[model samples]
Target: MSEQKKKIERLTGVKGMNDILPADAPLWEFFEATVRSLLKSYGYQNIRTPIVEHTQLFTRGIGEVTDIVEKEMYSFTDALNGEKLTLRPENTAAVVRASIEHNLLYDGPKRLWYVGPMFRHERPQRGRYRQFHQVGVEALGFAGPDADAEIIMMCQRLWDDLGLTGIRLEINSLGQADERAAHRRELIAYLEQHADRLDEDGKRRLHTNPLRVLDTKNPAMQELVDNAPRLLDFLGEASLAHFEGLQRLLRENNIPHKINPRLVRGLDYYNLTVFEWVTDQLGSQGTVAGGGRYDPLVEQLGGKPAPSCGWAMGVERILELLKDAQRVPEPDGCDIYVVHQGEPARIRAFIAAERLRDAGLDVILHCSADGGPASFKSQMKRADASGAAYAVIIGDDEVAADNATVKPLRGAQAGDADAAGASQQQSVAFDALAEHLIERMTA
Candidate 1:
């Protein structure tokens, strides 16, 4: 009796998690490389921590009432140990945990940066994803607003380097905890007075996090929020002084900015200056990057009290802006593509490819997708499609002569004497092939 075969089910990625296909991988590489170089130039070193942590790390550091901890976090119980764990919704809390665990502040202050994926359980949209990547920096042990201004200026420099514009800065001082307490009292009172005007989300956050109510996007509550008590008015003498000092430095450096009274960032740990770099390009999701001073987060997470300020920018959001600005970088194509057929020619092609690579050239050796060697005509088609500048061709005839024909596949490079449409070919001996290709490429 013949047994019936069971059909296999096709699997797909999780709902909001996306794949960075080959077509989009180049842009991601370009963005990451540019950010790495920029952070290095600013004396910021990289620090990477685990993607999962104790669930309490965020509930304690980011606050239990905040949206991230309450509704957006991906939390679960470890099946083996019954311990609570969460895929980090953001990097700042985890960074603080690492700094505390490692005692990184033992020697004065440290300027550190990180880049990796973050997970959030939310409906994915154009610029928002379930799994997103962020590039952030943290400067620990810096008490003054100078560290704050330096990081802000660093962001400005990155924008200029990347040739991006249309993003503007908005700054606000959350002041000290005492000052925020005073503001919170008045803010709660005011919201209660207009309790009838509050929406479901606004009413829910009215008492627990009154400052967030002022940040409501509900058009119906705009008037009530706009008329609410401003946090700036509650800033005490030293808090006002620090805020003013940051402004002076920004003005002297010619960095344009504004102060928004309702700019309480969506986190509980922030205490002093808070700022955001926002853009209109992405529609509702306008904030591309934001961070501020959290002098208490170190101690809150079990480290000795240390002041820290940093910012994190969305990699996907910034890349979208780059495309909107028509600044997408070209894909990285190899300098040479080696195409060969027949067993003897294939062996020689492998050796030639390695030699060229040893000479600091990018090369791709041709091979059949099927188990057999592809035809010469088919291989030539791939060599052209690969975007390689030159094709190193070898066949049975050339293999017997111990030679390979180097032909320009994409026309002449800069400074070459050949016309735009001309193809130039040269036969070179196997022993001197690498040197010959190098000289021609450099020329």
Candidate 2:
């Protein structure tokens, strides 16, 4: 007897990583297209950077004490040359790195944006994932608060365009390094007094990153954090002016916001203006988007001092809100599905599909798994399932006459109530098929 074959185990995706399947692709496309158009209207151009970068870039840029660098970065040493590399956890550092390397600021300031995936190893939940996508906007070489207000206003415009509600803005000022230093000293002293109330993460970050501890999520430590010395109290003349300037711009634009003194962003590079767009819809992941000014980051990353402001919004979180708000567009499918049977009919169908496509129509040509044509009934079933507005049916008889049967698969054609029910079909010559479909669809 032949030896029994072994069964192979099924493979699954990484725990926190997820896939965006075909059924959900339309919503993703809609969201991305809306963002693209809105950014363009404001004169922002697109920029893409490598997903992998030298691990040290983030370590020194985002700060080693932060949760992302300390615990979440996906870092590995190259087996080929032993160079340490990391899949970017967040994109701000990478964006700055790219700008410096390319000398993009040589001409002048730039309004740029990026949309891509970011990696971090964390427990995935409702709105959070290990491999998530972000839409980021950066204004480089702008020193004034106008750039800050511009990016914030850009985010507000996006929210309105996407029809999302219940999201509120909160702003704060981190001041300059010296101002934060003074507050850091006082913050450490205060937290140390109530060290017993500090969570493990808070205790560990007490001296190294005291400002972050104020932004903690521990319910038990809320009281201790709220009473800790506020960073705004430590801002000097220049820093306070910048902060107030941003607020005045927001007010003139009628953007409603509150000052959250504890709004120190996660990265170490941020200074001066900081803000977050929060919502109650997504539990625990209430912060859908957040960012701030990181004027010193270019210099910190070995480039000449250049001021920059930017923000990143989580794609999954925004998509979830879109679905929750029922604002998703209809699923994207072909405008026409070509269903045919018989070897000769299939060949004719392929030709017809190409002709229709050449007319700027979206078309799907049917096929069978075993290279033999499926029954007309089976192909029609698929045509209906494709969400196609119409199906072009062909068979041996139609192929002989060089004609195709055009059947409505969706909504009723003008003056024909039963057309959507597939009760209406007409034979059209192959040459005039494209125009015929166009006229009927328009009707």
Candidate 3:
């Protein structure tokens, strides 16, 4: 290859991964900020865990038979200790493990939220990356249907805040262990009758988790899956009551939802109340967020038996939905731009800029001294391009006079003649420019 092509190859990110450029930062910031604020209002504290954990955590917690543990985990051996570690495919197991390890449950029921990267070895596609981000909430040590209701409401609130419409909430109950065991027996027998027709993956699932056959999206498998026994039919009395209580709570809160019996989530730890938030806009991989009540996950992760229910939304998928609906907000603009014309004015601009920043205003300072008076026009243009609401013009005249011109950086004519006219310009005290910008921006 030519040297230019070789250089270009070295500049690319790995396949299935992407670098979030500056233009995309605002969307991420808005989503995270809105989630944090919403979760805070609902009394959820922030929690963070290591990015990599023992590979066995997922193997046991997410289940060895699941695609995540079996195929998608980025597992590697630690060079120093020869211990095995894997970048987390999801955060639920790690969060539960942290709660147990730290005894975070001692202070009663705990509510926590996390936002970070998650890795999975998958084909890169639109809204699906091997390295993606997730914003999730975990409510540990809570068992009642009310906890489930709270989380569903919180998820709805987040979607609404993002201006996402046409979202469908699908929920299901996987029931307790004993209930699942009975259903598993019946499901296995039913699949066995059609064993010869099963695909390779379906056959493997039949031997491991027969319930997963219902999760298949293959059109050929749909007929067989449609005839399979539904979990709702097999749920015991207690499981039935739990499902009813959740539905009742959702009804009381006026949250519209439909009960989907086939959403047995791609994990073994999930028990009861498996739900997903899907949007029709995104074609095949439409699931934006999905999780369920994992009462056994904490215990499986070496923590004391603590019932927990939570959900994790893929940031990539959510962003796709926003983009499809044209709902993503415009990038934020700077509040004020400080333009200087001379060396003394540049120095004063630097000092004044710091003061404005310390006073909680977003200020951008143009400190070049070579531009002279002619540079003021270009500086003004820069200020306009920065999306600043106001521009502070500082020159030798203003610095010597201990005054500044606070011009509303809008309604500018083509030439400086209109801008230079005293009748068109507004002069404010040099020290009060920050307050003036704040008042104007706020107004």
Clashes of each: 0, 0, 0
Clashing residue pairs in candidate 3 are none
Instruction: List where candidate 1 sits over 4 angstroms from the true fold.
Output: 1-4, 413-422
Question: Against the unseen true structure, what C-alpha lDDT does each candidate score?
Answer: 0.91, 0.92, 0.86
lDDT tens string, model 2, 331-353?
A: 87789999988888888999999
Residue-wise C-alpha lDDT for candidate 1, range 23-112, written one tens digit per residue: 999889888889999988989999999999999999999999999998999999999999999999999999989988888889889999
RMSD of each: 2.1, 2.0, 3.3
Instruction: Judge candidate 1 at residue 344 and give its lDDT.
Output: 85
Cα-lDDT of candidate 3: 0.86
Clashing pairs in 2: none
Question: How well does each candidate superpose onto the true structure, as a TM-score?
Answer: 0.96, 0.96, 0.91
**Candidate 3 similarity to native, TM-score:** 0.91
**How displaced is residue 16 in candidate 2, in Å?**
0.7
Question: Which residue pairs in candidate 1 collide?
Answer: none
lDDT of 3 by residue, 245-320 (tens): 9999999988999988888899888898889988778888889988879999888888778899999999989988
Instruction: Report how far off residue 374 is in candidate 1 (Å).
Output: 1.8
